[model samples]
Target: MNFIKTPTLLKNKSLSLLITARVSSNFAYQMLTVAIGWQMYSLTHSAFYLGLIGLVQFLPMLVLSLFVGHISDRYDRRKIVSISQLVQGICIALLAFGNYNGWITKESFLIMVFFIALAHSFEGPPMQALLPNIVERKIFPKASALVSSASQFAVIVGPGFAGILYSFGASLIYSITAGLLILASVLIIQIHVNKEERKPDPVNLKSFFAGITFIKSRPIILGAISLDLFAVLFGGATALLPIYASSILKIGSFGLGVLRSAPAVGALLMSALLTRKPLKRNVGKIMFTAVVCFGLSTIIFAISKSVIVSFLALFVLGASDVISVVIRSTLVQLETPDNMRGRVSSVNMIFIGTSNQLGEFESGITASLLGTVPAALLGGVGTILVVLIWRKLFSSLFTVDSFEGSKN
Candidate 1:
């Protein structure tokens, strides 16, 4: 937190507002995730249903990503973000009401998740595109590090808060999440962006596909994005945390909260370090190395029985992931032009977001089929293999020495 005070990027009013908004929104998201995962698992007692949560959320975003990207490129990104937050807040509120009335079912819960995912799909690209506009290019890494820190801090606090609140009732947690989301929306609305005055171009198929085309054209960007996609898809163990908490670890809800927070705690620590000493050399090689560590950590986590060992594995998992996040985010934002940032970011979001959701589904199905231990072990091995294959396929990515050179 002290590092946030030292960064000159925080001195920029708009960037500060953006960071505040991100923290608030991420807090709500983290809380909601805890509540939903717990509720779904408690209701169905099935990992598959928990996995279905990801599937339901993913479908809407997959469908809406291109349109959302196009809108971000053309409209006031601030407004788009604010509106999405408002919609998500409303959805959370409705979910709370349903739960309170005892009318919510698994079917209804999945439906609400779909709506929330729709809002998030719209929110992601513009929010990403909006960052560079608010900060100086020279301090982009610092800004990114601070922003990531805030987000991870929220992750650290939100689930822990949810665990305590959940002892009372899930309705209480949902109500609180709804309020935080609305607050995030208000905070984002206060940030001002200098809108470019340009002739409005008609929406067309070609313009819609521009982001995809641009990413495909740049091998570095493609490499970075795809690397994350496959790595997370195979290595992520998030979807099965509930199973781990209940069956394998026997720690219950509070322990589940701790397990969820472990990664964020590690990420927060790493982000703080990065803010002090941002990566200045061998950025690409560092990213690849971090990902391989992520895979190895996940494997350790998968096999561990002791809570202490599990937490440590997850902590390392989170730490390594933050390294990859900082590097990849900087590359994507700096490499793209202003006009194309929205679209490119949208494409990037699709890749990243899809990997997460689909990864959960993969975890769920694999756990159901192969059992949790083997499934997670398989994922870890797959992640390492993806890294080896990517190293060969995207060899140019590893040679890059600086973020400055990543600019397209």
Candidate 2:
């Protein structure tokens, strides 16, 4: 197949800077995730505690998403993202200090996780909403692909880097994370945002809940977002990776890093490919098919004992997920108005974010009760079931032919 020529999106300086910031921040966050999971497991050796880490991080989004969305719409989104990155950097620094002095306990680590989550909760809506402002509507898919690819590349590197650094010490891993976050904040600060277009309405109970109301009115958007929500909620196998690395696969931290990086490696490659040749026809069908493949890949990963086979499954999982992500992101960005983007993106975050973190919690609880292998096997099955149910409930989504003409 002939690769499409590069689009003009890359020529936009603000978009380039935004992608840089995303890559930097995501790299730090990915490393932090690996470090924390390893440390949490080492400290407690309990799946429940590992699950609680996700819950603690997600709680802030659950409680504050509405307010955060409102703020993103009303305030300077660039500033919101920069400030949140700074706060997160400080939190990482504190964690690093605690780790360095041998003073870090599970409680302290969890506390830091809460603050990190709180900062990110404030950052999520605005950061997502800012992209449309930076790129033209015609190039949204390419822009989204480039941005997602950058983050995926970070995901691939971050865990492997963290795993290597872990042999040195947890403090080293966290300290580096803090530095990367600070750098990300600096990069974000350099982007120039046009303020003339921003017209935020006064904050009120009605305005706060506007995002939820908007999503409800749009069946296609609602269906697309909810499909991901339930599928990932049941299908995600990431939370149990630590257990697999330790007990099932018998791989050490190095192997864990490789496993964590495998999906992103696939995702990054797929994302790069999408940028070259954007999806056009049968978008909805493609998304549904990719998700089913994701479930099947998860099942393969769950049952595999060989490291190579597990990596291949995760690679497929990541590749399938990128197809869904590019479609969903393009749909959400194109369907919503600029003023409402922040709010809509916030609602989107709640669904996708909750699915990720809550999925981790569910995996932990199930692993505790059903054993790790069975828990993951069941999650894969649940993902397939969700796809079937969603196909029936959101039949409109299945018929969507193009991202540009998607109806709200």
Candidate 3:
């Protein structure tokens, strides 16, 4: 997974390779989740199972967070990532085979989902850590935005495409997902990092918690990371999209795909703009404001019965989220030393995974008890409250004005 350094053009090629690798894998999973959500909800007719799916995915990330950082920093991160994709592909192939044979049940499906999450738990941090290695520091913010663009673009297409393909059967969806994941593995193998020496310290208990310690010590980094963690923790309504598609908007699987892809559409557009012109001023204020916008969009989405209005709200939501993501990612990578980036990234991943997967569980339970619309509205309002509180708590983050800050 590690290769010799080459020219600047090769660096760009490596960057492209990284983005393609990311896009392929991300696209595959986006499709996988779309199909899985539809299948699970169809079989059970329960939103709780959807939350269970989130819980299954989340337990692994929470359990594995301690060790993943040490492994990423100490081993070949690219190999780790490629191997993770390989495992996921194999699991998807098993899913396809099982579905074809007519033995896949909800219980069995969740078991498979756990393994997929297990593989993904190893994948996330290493993948995040890989970006800084590809491009020079000066160009990293632009490259980071480009990497986000690839992810967003994948999200934009994969679900909508999955909805179209889903008419054939779950087996077809699973088969295609497996193939794309394998392609991602292949692409990851081709990426060559710059000659950044990976100086891994010997593994110990201390190393496991180092990432957390590192984050807690840096206020700007801490502020950025925690802001995303809590904001999205309350704001995310991803786990409930299936319910919305089927019951609320009455939009079937294709409409579900459209609703799912809507945010990514906005995110892709925003990321493209950022790639062209990275944020130059008021970085902290911009991120906080973006979170507030995200909350407002969620509220709009929760209340809207009209398909067009919901999609538009989601579009605005995606655009707002990318702003927070790009700023937080840039700050985390730019400030951390290379040796600690993986550990730091692992901690960051835990927060991200928690905010998303755990948030899914939160949405699911809330939806089950309070009804979907109320649950979603609560999330939107909670997100805004979190932002207001975080601003007071993390005052250091609000005054910061640029990406060119003190590097640790």
Task: Evaluate all candidate structures by whole-model CA lDDT and list the values in order.
Answer: 0.88, 0.89, 0.88
Count of residue pairs whose backbone atoms collide, per candidate: 0, 0, 0
lDDT of 1 by residue, 233-303 (tens): 99868889989999999998888889989999999999999988999999989999999999999899999
**Alpha carbon lDDT at 182, candidate 1:** 90
TM-score of 3: 0.96
Least accurate 10 contiguous residues by lDDT in model 2? 1-10
- Evaluate model 2: give its lDDT: 0.89
User: What lDDT is reached at residue 344 by model 2?
Assistant: 88
Listed in order, each prediction's TM-score against the native is 0.98, 0.97, 0.96
What is candidate 1's CA lDDT for residue 327? 92
Which should have the higher TM-score, number 1 or number 3? 1
Reference-based lDDT, residue 304, model 2:
94
